[model samples]
Target: METSWEEILEEVSKQIPPKYFTNFIAPLHFVRWEGNQMVVSAPSQIIKSHVEAKYANFLENAAYQIKGDSFRLVLLTDKEESTSHMKDAIENRFQNSEPELNSEYNFETYIVSDCNRLAFTAAKSICEHPGKYNPLYLFGPVGVGKTHLLHAIGNEIKKKDPWKTIRYVDSISFLNEFIFTVRQNNRDSLESFKMRYQSYNVLLFDDIQFLNGGAEKTQEEFFALFNFLYERKRQIVIASDRPSYELPLHDRLKSRFVHGLQADVKEHDLSLRKELLRSYTIQYNIPISEETLEWLAQNCDGDSRALIGIVNDLVLYKKAYQFFLLSDEKIREIANSRLQTNRKRIGFNPDQVIDLVCEKLNVARKDILGKSRKVDFILPRHLCMLLLHEILGLPKAQIGRIFSAQHTTVIHGITKIKEKFSEDKNLFDLYQSIKHQISFQ
Candidate 1:
């Protein structure tokens, strides 16, 4: 008997989670088979690319399993173009396009918590009523879902009104493109570039902080674009590593950024972290016990990206070793190893260094900042000063303000710690241990 397409899909569905299947695979229609190739129809180019990248292998294997014969796979859009034509279609679509919005980063996949609820709500509001905020500015630290929300807004708007045009571009790309156009030194080239940006109904700009240093022309162009879109009441969304007020752009540009709504995303709390872990486990189809999930959530102390990374590592381990059940001990080992390998040593701030020193030395923060001259208080205080200066590269004057001391006092404290480190082996070991903890954190 010949195997039907339904049977092949059934086999493939067994391996993919239901949500993923519904989103990526259920929309696909099996077109007619041509010779030894199975042609499938995807609803859109985005869906076609995702399915081809992630599920093409599983789909091909499923067909082989059901039919007992090898066959090639070909995915086409609803247009049902031939393979040769599909290449041309894709090239044309991307010929002058900005970065495509990721289909996978819609609101449904974003884990909302108190930390990001405001930003999420604001983004949703913009979709429902475009240009209400004019420019919905989202600011947060790295890995805190700012970029995700930016893409989410664009995806939501595009979904609701397919006719609406949207463009997503980062500051660096915007700058590079402007420089390329300027080198042409042609009046028409610059005008064409301006028209391309102004044509979009919605513009999603990311990492606006990158525009801070020495991109005067790009900043001017962006300023003009901002005025053009705002005056026309077109929706614009922006994201950055810091708040708009902190951005070092021209006064006019900074004033424009503050003209609209500004939403901030904070780091995930413990409950939020656990929820994120659970969501990722489900998304990746990893079987993790509640206890293991809790432990991993508590131990991994960064943003959602770090937690998801740990779960992804576990998925790789499971596939590599074929481990049906992962022991808690094994999971911890994997989490620790992955954390060390991917840890960013310079990601800490002065406040974090101070807190770590106080925690390790059992010294009160008040005493560290106070005029305490006791041996115990003095040592911890000096350690904080040294770490802040050496590790963070903070100026001595800035360190003085943090410790409520003069610059000379700050310099003396740091020098004292260095001398202690050279003379005392135990103090050196303690410093190393604290530094290690900071890196892993």
Candidate 2:
């Protein structure tokens, strides 16, 4: 008797581990459903061998037990591996479900760095095994790879487990949705959102630090959501500019985040930057030089998106109508210009500086300018005062007046900054730039 395709799938799935079904068969391609036989395509020959060697008997026995021993499982690769249909499906689904995550932000395109490498590997780990890492947290500076990592993980998880439901959104977006859900106050809407979170095999929230208004209510709700999914062994991942502790999070909320595996993404180091530039060069079909890449890497710092932007600008700057021409000097100039422009743009006032320096250096603005001489706030406090004094060239007394301290206090700040200048060249450069930015006269 000829077995139907539906029967063939039903019997096969029953024999395979229910948990592994999504992990294994979802990646397997249902290439063609011809009469009596099903042509499946594995991702690679290795996958084909594993299925055949390990699971083939189970599959064959399933066919015989359910319907008949007539259906054959032919694992093909040539046609289905082309990725045209899969790519379209992924792109279309993204367009519908998560439009903000750019379709281009896939694992193939992400740049791995020491800062983000552990986090990258962890995300990949969870993608491979959904329940292993609960509430994956990754934090770093702006323009870092946090969002890229989230997108890459989403795309990869989708590819690895096509049958599994996945949800990825930024924390701010989630916050807005959460607020609306609260406003609606409908049991069904709330339940539906909760179900979506709980039922999703993988859930990723970007910029989780945005949860950081330290608002008791929002944090409470999110904490519940995180706990609920975490308990079920479902995957929960988040990305933020900084870790939970670094931000002013409530103690309860803070404990939930740090309890999970968290990694700080490193700034873009030289080698990773080179790899990133090379990838962009290929994407734009341009031929960039090693020298240019080195220069860009040295100057562009840790932001890969910024590097890509530099590449696009280089393409336009080249102005070659026929084809993309990558030049060494052009890439360098673009990178340097961007770095300088960005560095030159960080703005603040005396009050803002005092507030920030006080917090970062863990000192009070008053003590910073006061005669406390307490080394605790002394270094950073003095550093800020020195920056103001040197850059603004404010009279010691006038600058002291702003911080409500003696003119001698301002003088002391300037002296400390100079003393630390050689030991911390980068710090000095930063002070000079800050001075430059605030220079009105």
Candidate 3:
């Protein structure tokens, strides 16, 4: 007797948690078995990729238990189907879309460090108590785990309540949909459009910083949807390049974002980066040495995406070159090729900033870093702290150490400089001059 997909799912459900089976595995369809290969279909490419990476083995095991043999699993998503079939899929997609949560970005796979621990915790809390957090705002620099956490919130919420309607979209997609509906100029389509997002129980919006300028109509629609979700106590998770209050959005929209819990995921420290790299190696079973891992973590400058890429590059290089162990020189070559892109060519650092400030402000290095709070030295000292904190990307504590001042003192100095820049035109000119010299050099 041939085992059906239902039977395989039955075994799979028994093996995994109910929520996991429902959220990540239930929507999958068993297409057919052909030529010793079992075909399964995921709703989207993200889901398919995730299933292939994390759940493929479990699926194989379940299928083997049912059929008494193991077969190769071939997973396909709706987007990857035949062109003719894709037309239908796309048509259905607009009617009622589901969250395109990346399976890999789930709670299990997300690396939790002090850098993102609060965001991670809040995301999990939202999943457990949907709408308890209401509008959870997650903001950070580019390539931080904001998008990952947003998706995790949606995924975990879906798992917690499989019946809940969840939608995850980037700002661009949300704006595109609104523009498409308006272009149609049909009343019914416009109504359908408004109803589309307002119906979701959970909304995850990524890179909301892009929604700052322009897109007036879309912003208005989102404001309405945001209100509807808020009134109904639905969960809303948003990710942006900066804090929600700092975005150039309308004041009304900004108020809504600020009203919610806003968490900032800081840049990954060296220790966090090391753990992230170690997680990647363990996930892929890549045979990288501890020293090499530490070196890569330090050299990668806390960029999670770059760390993952370096690991992938190393794995590929080893497979192609057939090396038992990757030497430091080979790793350096790979890092040079992959990591050098988009980095600063002029090589600006704290030392350079200090030198430029001294030349531009005509202040001796000693006075700038000295304990004396002389009136003349104040501007130069504050200017140096501002540059070190903003341009050099050094922490306030680190900048304080450089100047032999406390971290709070460093913050005060930077804030004072900003206030002075707004009030004093001459000081502002000097500030811009130093910025230009350092930036260009």
Q: How accurate locally, in lDDT, is each candidate?
A: 0.84, 0.68, 0.79
Root-mean-square deviation of every model: 17.3, 19.3, 16.5
Assess candidate 2 and give its TM-score to the true structure. 0.56
Write the residue-wise lDDT of candidate 3 on 1-441 in tens digits: 245678888888888888878888998977778777888888988888888988898888888888888888899886565653655565466665644678888888788887788888888877777887778988877777888887777778778789988888999877767776787679998998888788899889988988866878888888999999999998888888876767888999999986668887877766778888888878776666788877776566636886788888888988898887777778878866775553445568787788778888788988888988798898899999987766555656567789988755875788789878768999898877777776777
Q: Which tens-of-lDDT digit does each residue in 1-441 have in candidate 2?
A: 134445655676877787666666546656665576666777777778778777766665666666655667776664555654665564354335654446688776777766568878887787777777677888877876887888787788788778877787777767766666676568986776677667777778877767776556777878888888788887888787776776666777778776567877765656777788888878876686777666565555446777778777767766754445645665666667765555433355567666656665566667776667666766777777776544433334456667677644555566667768868888777666555545542
A best-first ranking of the candidates according to their lDDT comes to 1, 3, 2
| lDDT of each residue in 1-441, candidate 1, tens digit only | 134899988998999999999999989988878889998889899999999999999999999998888888899898756554555554354445558899989999988888899999999999999998878999987998988898899899999999998999899888877886787589997888899899999999999999975988888899999999999999999999887877988887888877778898876656778899899888877877899888776556568877888898989998899988678788889988875565445778787788888888888888888897899999999998877755665655567788888766876787689779868999999998987776676
Clashing pairs in 3: none
Model 2 poorest 10 in a row by lDDT: 388-397
Kindly give the number of clashing pairs for every candidate.
0, 3, 0
